[model samples]
Target: MGSERNEHPYGSLKDGDKISDKHKRELGRVRSSPTFRLGTLFTKSVEKPWRLLWLPFSILLLLVQVVKERVGATPRYSNSEPFTGESEQRNCVVFFPTNGVGLGHFTRLLSIARRMNKADPDMEVVFFTTSPTLHLLREEGFAAYHLPGRKEFSNMEASTWNSITEEMLSNVFAIHRPKAFLFDGSYPYRGMLNAIVRRDDILRIWVRRGTFKKNAPNVPIDSFDIFDYLIHPGDSVEPNIDEDETNNSIIHCDPVVLLDDEDIVASDVLKSRLGIPEDEIVAYIQLGAGNINDISSDISIILGVLHDAGVWAVMGESLLGSRIEISELPNVRILRDYPNSRYFSSFDFGVISGGYNSFHEAIMFSLPCICIPNSKTGMDDQFARAKVAEDAGFMLVEENVTRPRMKNLVSKIIDPENRQSMVESGNSLRKPNGASQIADHIARLIFRD
Candidate 1:
């Protein structure tokens, strides 16, 4: 199907023309015309000066269009009523996928938003998120509205969190005036869902990921009735979507990841940026932030094991000193950025969490990984994902990677035979990232495609 989409050349070639019948016909005879081709090339070469003269003007026009779009300059009625007749042109798909944890939800939403923009640049694909990592979106030239999110849930009460969530949504929606609101999370907080239910003009779309641990008692699926549609991003390559096949509101999609292999930072670039020597074998140890999983005590053990094995260790600053004090280890380096997965190619292998983003990136990048699922998370579905990775032989696991266990596993994992199998298994994944599917569906609704 992807090959067909590529061959068809309509969607893939956004903002550019594809091979038409005229082009095919021209190529047939043009191949025989060396002199005519030469003349045409000569004429085009002579016209370069004129083209150059107009280049600045072209750029200026494009810049004006972009600025106009960015400011929401078009005049429209602000009446508390739905658009009817010909004035119902949708300009944006406001996304609310921010989380207090890692950048998984934001990155996944970004992947889709970017795709949507590529398809229709006029459509203002905006982010109404609570993520403090707005700089990440800004760097990519995306407009995002900040929401006051509680980073730590240690002392937060349910009622308090609900109120905060509701107020955040209400404030953001009033400002952006979005035609559609895409909520990407396991449970849509009562406040946001209630807001969506009360609005007739707004199209509520739920972007939920599945393969949630069976033991994890989630909110009843009936609550999802408030959404007009549910985009369920599957966990496995060939996941059995039949279990919830009767849910008419759900549109199943492939697993979503921020970056594919091509987006990986070059090994040399990564090494230079991180100040690591070219020849050193690196293991990126990320057990996730303390809010997700508290593997503080085990960080020292993993680092010690890697150090003894003559391997360098790299970790996110959030992971270092989470559980306990981190000493000045010469071999351990801290990554201080969001979506650290982009630099995944720089490392030789990984010690990571079994969350969706981590698991997807490990396989997507073909990294030899030892995955540790967070058993304490009530809403997390890491164990199921870890089982998939284990069956594929792409991942090694431990309930709690103790000092002794890590030391033994290191030797077994780094063995040439097992490492080769792990790498091969990672490379065997055929599932797409499903970003385009999300973008396309929303684009159809937004642009009436």
Candidate 2:
């Protein structure tokens, strides 16, 4: 029967013989397969060793990966603080009121710096400014450095002027190794300016008094990079252009006015001393400290207009040198060297041109101003800032103004309804207590330790 024929391994019998010859051969092969059993046992034994090794190895790899990720994911903090130990030294310094220009920028910067110094005694603030501003700072009992500036006004070509200014900057930076430098204008001498800043490893800051959209047309915005930080002196007025139009480096701090509690007290005293009646409207006319020749004509026109409205003029320092005599006008008061703070509150209204001090102080006092922008005298920024103010309902009078136009504008501004509207608008726009905010920002920047 096929040798007891083996049903094929464990299956039922097939058709004819219950198991064919092929089935018999398969059963014999199975009975003889010790080699296959040995091979199966060998493969299983090999897999067991690999599995034992892989479990511990995979666990070790996972632990290493986790530790690596933990180390790699740590956050980075800025090491802005100067060295404190024997190996290194730490210093903080600021540059304000750059030489050979308007006192307004210098005065405003000085005011902010003074506030900062009062708050923190440890900081070192170096003022690299004109001799006149430095003298004023010295009188205030602040340490200041004076850079020798050219007093003569000769129009030199741009290339020649640039070289001269660069040399001047090199000399200034060599004397003062400041860690941080602050310049007032939007456009400064970039070649010399950047060289000094870069060489000293200083973090350069630019105090942009106002927006770039208004300044870009007149100032060289394309030539220089946007400042590391820009301090706008007014309430955050939206720029006229898209955000993409400006370089993204600027950090806009609050507009800074130098007036504080002492200044306010002094202003009150001056108001009382000047016999400026609290009830009557008093207008301060500040044409600025520089360039009386270009703005004098407009000043006469504005004065004539204010005189007609029965508004008193508290003329700024520029009036002292003006050829046009205001001595004849009984209502107008020539404010020669009055404490700036005291004179500020003496006015119910402010009719001034663009200067950092007058603009900010007027806002600080909540006084409505009819801004007559005077550009011919190196103040190209006045018109642009005036435009922003005008859009917000402040009155605007252009330079080289005529008597009739000035009179008409002043008459309208003095009108009860007009004056009320302007006052309300000014109050809405004024961020009265910004000095503390500015001080805090500066403190944090200077003292991160």
Candidate 3:
């Protein structure tokens, strides 16, 4: 947490140091026009003259004002400082989750927030997200602010969308004045960095799970300097990538899961609710949320195997993408559920992709699953995560996925002894969910007397 402000673009300027041309332009442009409402600096400035000589004097005056504001923003909290209990009255923490191609980011943050609130009932948690699953948040009784991603707007340039993000997110901060800010995503957006600049009042945190491939692009080093803490949720296999000193306090915890074992419904009750026969064996299938119509898709192959093997199937459909449609297949049901781990008890085994959330959930729940890792995901090394489980004899990984191979794996998984062995192994290796540990840490930081 004792990071140098020099690493940031807006870091303190010295007597001999030169101001970057970009910040000067930003100050001028934001002052001259009312549209650029990024930080709290809203003072009006004179229009630029036709003569270039006036530029130096104008920049000098603006720099003086910015320096005064920065001084006010940099007030350090001393140990002897009296606790006013101001934040307790507000008692809010803001969570920002990027709308990735999947719901991994949103769900992980949700898991943490839920634990935080449960541990401290007085804490009010709010979400500021680009995720389309605001309805899901509301159902969980948390207020969420939504901003559509750049892809959602037709013909809008990325810069313009970022400007909108900065303006809207800044407004949210003004309204809530949250005690802390937590973001879970691979890359921190420019707008996010701009809006959160010099907010020394709020404890800023970033949650980044690792398992990236070698070719993955690195996040900006300067971006890492902006946060007070970096929390890395652990993976089954520690990623092969090297970790650098990002100058922020880093905390490593066990894998985060949304639901505990007690949260799972009883198998008989869950089956009855789904209109499934109590005597039937069920397999839960959740590949990715890609195009389902492709006949050669993995889901199709798995479905064919299940049908032939006479096993009932419950397919997990995601809430983010388009609805999955298929002609009626007997004894096959489609469950469009959020945090599908709640239903893990009803299924005998799972055929799931090795995304962070699903793979971790399967292991935590002791659900014997055959993991088929998705190779195309940007940062998550799904294969590496699955290989760790496979090597530990807790699960199986089928990389090539053929009908014969899948059928054989499915048959092997459903055997009573094999399933029991996998379950026992996973139970031995299981760790307490990281969400509670993170939640308690946050409470200590914000509520310490």
Candidate 4:
């Protein structure tokens, strides 16, 4: 645990006492006497002339410390490798994503970074995160740093945690000296803000997906001013709530999916890999990580329906959660792949939650899906997003899901003609992958400038 290593007297101060315990009683009486009070007042009167002289000196020392930090002073962390900008590599970009209930924020930033790298092979990409999934980023061949979440600390103040965040991130910036820094999350941390406060050399960007509920608590308005660019990943449905237009230039792009059309695994290849016969009817079920709400009952009901219908079911296990316990059956299987959308085309149809990434991915891939929106989220209006797809004949929405409703929907979706109609609607409404477009924009802003 970091507790032993980070043990500091942050909350253990005792009025700056230095007197020995043995002499404390006599000292206390002398301090409390009227003579002591008179002496203190006399001393203060005598020191008044020198107060102005010492105050300026103290303020000057504080100013010097602030200036040192603002000017990219040496990082305080032992592992820091400060960037000297003398290496052959340049055009670096750093991505910072907060660990959400699932992989929403992390996947979005990873998608953009992938496209950017594909476009500019020499562009250096890095990651700094509090998410526990550092292994996945390393698997993708990206350099990443990790900071444990504030909850990991025992009885530490939020301010202290943020100070740690600031130091760690500042060290990363010192090492990479990125040309641009992108953050993908709803709320930006104070530590993150402080880390980049004086880094005018880099372009600050915010990649915030939009679909927040009207009454939900949102990111602070002034926080938007800190970024030079804000990219709003478009939603399927236009939100009914009025959006404030006063923030930094908001770059509205189409839904950002991780994989492009060519990137999707061939249906035959995917099916063969999963050991499914070519003739079997397969359904893919992917609720979220089951962190914010219980999804076990829902999964059980869907599995039962599929089993009854003789449909081979493959459940997507979230990387953030422990393995789900499922009753072993010949037709049921579990997939632990990150970016499950690569195999979306292999499924006959899907039963998925209405998250921004998965919802748009199902549409982008033309996979006729049943959108079982998770409405327990703090801000996402999943029902609204699903309803838009439903209205457009892209898919069906099951808000209060049950066996009968799921079975009926499954029966209708399995019909060849109905499935084709849904596929056509999706194909007709599909936008070009927004991840590549955003990558192009980033290139133009950083490389071309």
Per-prediction TM-score to the true structure, in the order listed? 0.73, 0.65, 0.80, 0.79
Q: Score residue 424 of candidate 2 by CA lDDT.
A: 74
Q: What is the per-residue lDDT of model 1 for residues 1-449, given as tens digits with 9 covering 90 to 100?
A: 11001122112211121223224323433542434434544466467866656565655664565455334342111112222212232455688885735566777888888777777665566787766667777887888877555545677776577666665565555445566788887655655654455455777787877666666454534446667787887675344334453344777787888776677777887788778899988888778766755566777788889989988888866522343355578888877665677888788789888877778878877788888887776566677778878887888888777888898889877776888888998776647778888878876665453
Candidate number with the higher lDDT (1 or 3): 3
Candidates ranked by lDDT, best first? 4, 3, 1, 2
lDDT tens digits by residue: candidate 2, 1-449: 00111122222233232224224433433533444434444566577866555555555654564454334332111112221211122254556565434565675677667776677665556676644545566776666655444444366565465446554554444344344667775446533442342232555666655544443444434323434555555533554434354553555555667665456654456556677666677787776664444665666777777877888777776422444355577777767663354556566677777655667666666667777765654434566666666777755546657877777677777777887787677665576555566566756654454
**lDDT: the better of candidates 1 and 2:** 1
Candidate 1 structure lDDT = 0.67
Angstrom error at residue 444, model 1: 2.2
Over 1-449, each residue of candidate 4 has an lDDT whose tens digit, in order, gives 00011122211112222112113423543664445644555566567966555655655654565455334352211112222232222467899989887888898889899988777666677999988999888887899999988887798897789878876776676556577899998777867875665455678998987788887775544466668888888788764433474457778788888888887987887678879999888998888777789888888888888888889998998888888886677888888987898988789999999988788889888889998999888878888888888988988999888999989998998888999999988876689888887888887877553
Expressed as tens digits, the lDDT of each residue in 350-429 for candidate 3 is 99988888888998888889999888778778898888888888889988888899988988988889999999878765
> How many clashes would you count in candidate 1?
1
Best by TM-score: 3
lDDT of 2: 0.56
Q: Model-by-model lDDT, in order?
A: 0.67, 0.56, 0.75, 0.76
Residue 331 of model 2 has an lDDT of 72
Q: How many residue pairs clash in each candidate at the backbone level? A: 1, 3, 0, 0
Worst 10 residues of 4 by lDDT: 1-10
RMSD of each: 21.8, 29.0, 10.2, 12.2
